[model samples]
Target: MADATVRPESRWYGPLAATPRHLFVPRWWSPGERDGTWVYELRDGASDPDAWMSCAYDKSLSVITRVGPHHADHAASAAVVPEAWPTSSATLPALVVKLYQHAFLADDSRLLVTCGSGYGTALACRRLGDGRVTSVDVDPYLIQSARDRLAAAGHRPQLEICDVTGALPGVYDRIVSTVSVQGIPASWLAALAPGGRMVTALSGTGLLIVADKTADGGATGQVAPEPAAFMGTRHGDDYPPAPDHADLWATARKADGESVTTGRYPVMRVNSTWDVRSTLELTVPGIEHRMESGADGTRTAYMLHPDGSWARATAPGARQVPTVHQGGPRRLWDELDRIRTWLVIDGDLPVAGAAVRIDPDGTCHLSRSGWSASIGAQ
Candidate 1:
């Protein structure tokens, strides 16, 4: 499956085909729906070799290795964890190839890439040679485990336990990250050798930022047309617990708000649409989304922001208009509708293929069709 997904002419094809993905992830978290909640079912390779082989080689499937701090290997056989967020995974093969393609590596380019399952790092070593590949991860265990697996695969590359957003270990011609970041880390700009390139996704959005280092410790490029949403980078073994939003959730779920009106469109889950979701996220970051469908063919969508704003919309069925309720200081639904309106009128959102300019302080300016927005660095 991996060989078919990676084009034969590409440099990464050979490496991706040669590496054994199952070796790096002998046990992984496989998500399944149980009742109304999501659960992680651990899949051990030794127990189910056929199922393991099928999953390991699937081109588009990412096998989750850790949920918060609970590693799949540490769990008892047949364990099922409910409502736990995945913290780490072996990234899908095609996406890894997409990132490498965006980097535009040359034969002599020294590369620094993120290490997740060690599969990507192995591919890099196979394509670019072990001496030129350097991989880093925030978790020491991940780094150590990747090093051992990579060695077992007959490749020894530099592996370090370092936060990708912090100061890097050495200079390199390219730095690619599978994890997303809220902003362009200043350290990346500083560590990139002159004229180097980077490919990374913006946090909370499906924007694939591709940029090249400049003389003044900044970068200039544009967002790719393709959208990608990688897991956000973490500073510790597990992400710091999410903040309590019970009060806000309760209001959004049931309470009548300060404003009520007929919505312009039907109740839609913004997260399910890449273009609309990306535009909305860029317009208003940090909005949690939830959607539920009733047995009577009614659909309801809720949007909650950290700033005490909440919005809920409901529609009786497909193609039916929705009624919206909003509360708090800001009208969260209005912002989302405004972005959607822009898309409807202009035929597309500026976020797709927008020009990106990163300043020395890590402030990213995105502009397209006379519209511009800034992210990060205040």
Candidate 2:
């Protein structure tokens, strides 16, 4: 929150200093897990100035604006919403800066940026001038509100309400997205000016892909070493309700599956580790992960796929191996173990800095060290 010492001393600094993030997000949601229930706590800047300043200026924390269909600005002061997934937010400042830095923006660069809370767009406008920045979002309200806020901050950039994956508002020298996509949209390739670059994270994983537009309307680049997570782009007011996997949840929590094996390692919350998790995600996308621990020092982990594949693993403690149960078409835990074994043998996963070749049709092929994987259009 207090980073006075770390300064890049570029055009961004003056804009970052001039633009107040709090103005764009007067009220936002801060998430917390309590009693196994996911809760969104609304924080009002007017009521709690100290808390607002602490979080608003913090360089690493994202302030959620919309959770599901609920927007914090519309919520009652001090309201807490239970079991809501953040749909929109003002992304962490440092990560925004990271995306911009990866873009390698020149002073004269024309940028097409995504508008969430519009804080990032404001920063871009500050750096490249309002005339060179075009900001778009799927939510019409977000676009209008952000336009007003940017004007209040003494800047006005082109703002439009448009789905990011469909068609961009304009051709640009840089296309930076805070939203995640399963694969680079074909429309993006057509819209990007030649020699322009794009920076975005792949959906369901923390892989930050940096690619430059190629002569063939495709792109080729390497995955960044660092990890970043962003909400997937949404077309509707809310993401579809997650599948009701009551039977699968019960089986994963208590029932034994077709086969049981002693795991080679302890219960691992694989989703917590970016490298392994990203590799597993790259190998098998759209798998949901969950983990819980018992009072008796027992740990349990579950993996569920929309295809009805499920796996459960339990361990006694950190030192003891887990007993795994897998069912459905795929042995989910076994696949995870196979990936881990590969990592053990190679000392690293290919997902780290893998070569990314995105086709004109939106299929992405990632390869490294003789390993290969692909993400089809979502």
Collision pairs in model 1: none
**Residue 232, model 1: Cα distance from true site in angstroms:** 0.4
Those runs of model 2 whose alpha carbons end farther than 4 Å from true positions after fitting are 1-5, 33-36
Compared with the true structure, what per-residue lDDT tens digits does model 2 show for residues 87-126?
9999988889889989999988989999999999989988
TM-score of each: 0.97, 0.96
The alpha-carbon lDDT assigned to residue 348 of candidate 2 equals 89
Error of 2 at 205 (Å): 0.5
Q: What C-alpha lDDT does candidate 2 achieve relative to the native structure?
A: 0.87
Which residues of candidate 1, in runs, are more than 4 Å off? Answer: none
The candidate 2 region of ten consecutive residues with least summed lDDT is 1-10
lDDT, residue 130, candidate 2: 95
Summed over model 1, clashes come to: 0
